[model samples]
Target chain A: MSLRERYGGMTRAEQGVSLFVCGFTALLVVALLTGGLTPSYTLYLAGLTGMYVLLSLGLNAQWGYTGLINFSVAAFFGLGAYGAALVTASNSPLAIPGGVLVGLVLAVVGSAVVATAIAIPTLRLRADYLAIASLGLAEVVRQIVLNQRDWTNGSGGLRGIPDVFAGWPVLGPLPGELPGLQFAEYAVGIPGLFRIRVLGFTLGEPFWTDLLNFVAVVVFVAAVYLLLRRVHRSPWGRVLRTIRSDEELASALGKDTYAFKLQSFVLGSVVMALGGVFYAYLVAYVDPGDLEPINTFYVWIAVILGGSGSNRGAMFGGFVVVAIREGTRFASDILPARLPVDVPVLVDVYGAIVSDFGSTRLLIVGLLIVLVMRLRPEGVLPPQRELLWPSALEETDE
Target chain B: MALLELLANGLVFSSIIVLASIGLSLVYSIADFANFAHGDTMAVGAYAALLAFGVIGGVGPTVLALPVGFFLSLAVGGAVAALVAVITHVLVYEPLEVDSIGLLITSIGVAFVYRAIIQLRFGSNPVEFGIPLQRPIDALVPLGIRITVHEIAIVASAAILVVGLHLLLQYTDLGRKMRATADNPSLARVAGIRTRRIEWWTWIIGAGLAGVGGGFLGLYNQLSPRMGFDILLVVFAAVILGGIGSVYGAMAGGLLIGVINQLMPAISNVAVALPLVPNVGPAYADTVAFLIMVAVLLVRPSGIAGGETT
Candidate 1:
């Protein structure tokens, strides 16, 4: 479909969201062109956003589709990261010979096992039980990772992890083999010393590597999205939704809700681990800190705010999270350094805030969660289209 | 002798856990959601006490090595925490139209907001009360028990509060009404008991106890923005063990978990004594606690107290 046709099909809210997204993208590109932001940094941010999108999508499966409150998003993600890192990283104690392939398989498989183990006991209880249990279990996993020096290298973390395309034929050598491209610097409407140098950016090895990572994530996200779309419109997906809305009704229909819930939990967890697999390659590092509960909440915000049970919303929320994270860091750096005001008390207040921007980020995250739940519980772009199997819908029309 | 010392340490830690778990259990059933912010409420109380200490400035005599001002600050902390929780309930929770799960998720956000504000003001680094650290009592040295006066004070205060809560639940009109409401809110309303008023009272009594517990926790260790959050899982474990929404069970669960947590070294020693078992360290304390919670869920979902409220 053409851009105009797509725009025409969107609701007013969707249209507004699309326009805002476009505006933001354009501004980001402009910033890159003006040398205000580096190309490599922008690509890195995009890569992180893609990782988050994968996580949000994983969560959307459990929470949006089945209403399973699996708070172990971080746990699964960590397992995936550790899985890949252990087999692939140079510092790994039990480094396997199969490289990235082993890592990817291990990640998904490990997460599936953990998810199943967790689901068995908790899925039998109330919904909130899973939330509380998963959180505690996540902590348990992190502790094991932190203390198991023989296996995980303890808190020192694994490093020297190869890129995702390290063993690929052409792509393996792409980053190093690619030539550096530099844009000619131009003075923008100012005298020599005071001039802003626009278009002086260089696309080098780091940029190429980040771009490759971004491309891999794009492909991963696309594949997952198509798969989720198919599953979400199926009769099975309908049963899951039935369970989410009312478990008793689903049970009355002779559907085994526990098995369905367990399946959903494992599937979402594996997907989350896949995201972590990508993350291990993207950052080329893995640590216990990566499993922090805050990361889980970040994805939670993305899923809920973007619109629960909406694939596009999950994607949108993922991008917004990166914005919140890096935007705060950027603001903290720039705002404090160039405070034009000379007032003492004002300076002190501003200085204090910018000095510890971590707290500000936390506050923003907290407030956003509350505001989103309070103001728009359905989220920004709740599933607009009724989900039905394509063939079933067509038969009904006939 | 070493085991005895561990027992002593466990009792001290159990007092704080009991204080935290009781409030969480009370809120869990009555409020009809696991208040994730309940942990942060403890942090709020601790900080309030810290602030009150700053203002009170160790004025007057010291009791059990804690200044009279410290007790006043502890009271202030409890009051402030209750006030903050009531304000949050009125503003955030009461206004929002959502189910128990929604409230649970929102409470996570509430928790973050509380921690963030505390971190923003005090910075993230841990800080101790102005109260000087007390050495283990000279009298208990020969007995191999390294207990401090501050610890004794914590146990005493917690015991008093727990007893007070017991009396309130058993004898007071508000207590009876609170129990009736917890058992069945609609029925209580039909019976002319104002459930809303009871909920507020629950918040007051529950959060008030948590605040005092938090104050004692600060005395036991140091205060940080994440202090309560860090211990949240353990408290949750206690509540789940006692049975969620069961106040008396929370007390029993808290004591058991606390003792078990402190006795980690001894447990590891026992493990070492057994063939094919590896020795573990204190680092696995939370891990062990969580595992126990999972075990409890598997064995007795209703909890040790059989899932009865209050």
Candidate 2:
């Protein structure tokens, strides 16, 4: 009892907070390693992980909270990217600053619109049925992006979309020239602080686009994390979970389950769209090929790998996915020479195998998924019961 | 005449969908979830034939040896795919049994692993049956409608397999047992039927037929890693349309989708009649399934063949 009280009553909520912090710390360690080894692409890939994290979190809201299996995360994400790009691209009526701001807002609203359109008709069916429709929707969207030359540029890809930093004049003299972000660096001693040492080896110097983007992503992730935590404690979230756990009861109580489900689905996709805008700006390009069903699966893999229902798990999953995906590229570079004196032929064969790591990574990821599902279906960090009211009741009679 | 040709083309594709959807229907009823990897099972069958061809090299060319080559490819494809199905069932699906959602995710996992392995064994490029390179076979004009050797072969093989499956499910004691297990596994188990044994056979037979279906699809379309997945949703649309658990429903659904997908792009009037649509109708070939799917769920959620909700 004493131990339980010491660790905040050994409550699930404290464990959740501690685990989340651990996940964040692990991610910081990874980010530092990435920056240390591959200075150029670290922050850029971190931004990508942020993008995927948001995608998974969007999915988590539907599948984790409301038990809706929507397989069209990639579609909404693509729409968000394309929607924002269309609004902000140089050729658009709304360009640069105004377009960027309006485009971001429009991207979220447009995603909500798309989500509502799909949800209103389809939410009545079984969850897996929605999966079927969404899968087809993705294919249709991809076909449109691929076939329509006039509208989507027909797979040549759309480029020249300005980043948020690019639109901001105060941070300017056009920071595109900087090698990387010098605004802050993850200080060595305390990763938990995500402790940034501002004036990163320089004064009044602009940061690289990747660095600027990474900082923005960190802020975005933090804000999203706080918002989701709030939602988790809110009445709306309670209603969403009620619909998931006991739909008949929720309906019996006069709560419109369909409307709530649709609302949650739209809100999740709206977040995905916001992430999509960041992704579009970070990459400065959008290709129809990038929006494959596999991309969605990859996000799902991350979501499940990190723990689907937990927000911190989703964030960690995003990092793990990016790490496995991008980190393996350097596998061949690290192998072959690094192993202690080996059988020459065996070394050669191993080298040959690792050389195709790009394709084999799929096999590894697939195996990881199977193992994870079979062993830990709840995810790496399972959803725990959180303690909302920690204040003890006062005794007035004494 | 253009419409007739399109319908004929659609029938060829429909036959494949019908063949694949049968296996999916069986699995859906018994396993109680959609298997995202089933399409990959199609790929598995096609690639098995490809591997068999690599080993036996002369399965093509000589007119006298043509039938021998075809049977060999079919046998090898079916057998290898059955083996793979059994292995994955044992390794993944059986172990993750409590929740259908876990099984669903596991199916996706198997699909990823299978796709990666297929790409590893065979290079990333598309492979074709030796016949596609041969001189164009004369098109048969039966009652003034042109049909290629591919279409005839597809239709005939699909007919034989469907009829074969029907007989197996209806006449044989094994068929009755399989159907019983599919309908209600616990009830069948209580009735003294070896439910596990029945499931084992279901995987073998269902996946075998799926292999054959996949082989036929690849025969006409050419085999690629993405072929199975590309056709996955259409297969789901067919299976769901046919009333998910019914064999006959799968066949009917396949043909409907096959025809609709071919013809809808040209005549999906809802999009065509609208102004400033940018000629999206022809490009909307895949969109028809999703539109129809949403409509069907709204009007008749159980499906056309009257599939009961599990």
lDDT of 1 by residue, B1-310 (tens): 6999999999999999999999999998788899999989999999999999999968799888888999999999999999999999999999999999999999999999999989988999999896777899999989999999989999998999899899999999999998998889999999999899889988988898889888889889999999999999999999999998899999999999999999998898788889887667888988899989988988898899998887
Which residue ranges in model 2 land beyond 4 Å of their true spot? A1-38, A90-97, A173-208, A337-353, A385-387, A390-398, B57-66, B132-146, B264-278, B308-310
How many clashing residue pairs appear in each of the predictions shown? 0, 0
> What lDDT, from 0 to 1, does candidate 1 have?
0.90
Quality of candidate 1's docking, in CAPRI categories?
high
- Encode model 2's per-residue lDDT on B226-257: one tens digit a residue: 78888888888888888878878888988999
DockQ, candidate no. 2:
0.64
CA displacement after TM-score superposition, residue B152 of candidate 1 (Å) = 0.5
Best model number under DockQ: 1
Error of 1 at A138 (Å): 0.1
Stretches of candidate 1 exceeding 4 Å from the true structure: A187-196, A337-349, A386-398, B276-278
Q: Residue pairs in steric clash, candidate 1?
A: none
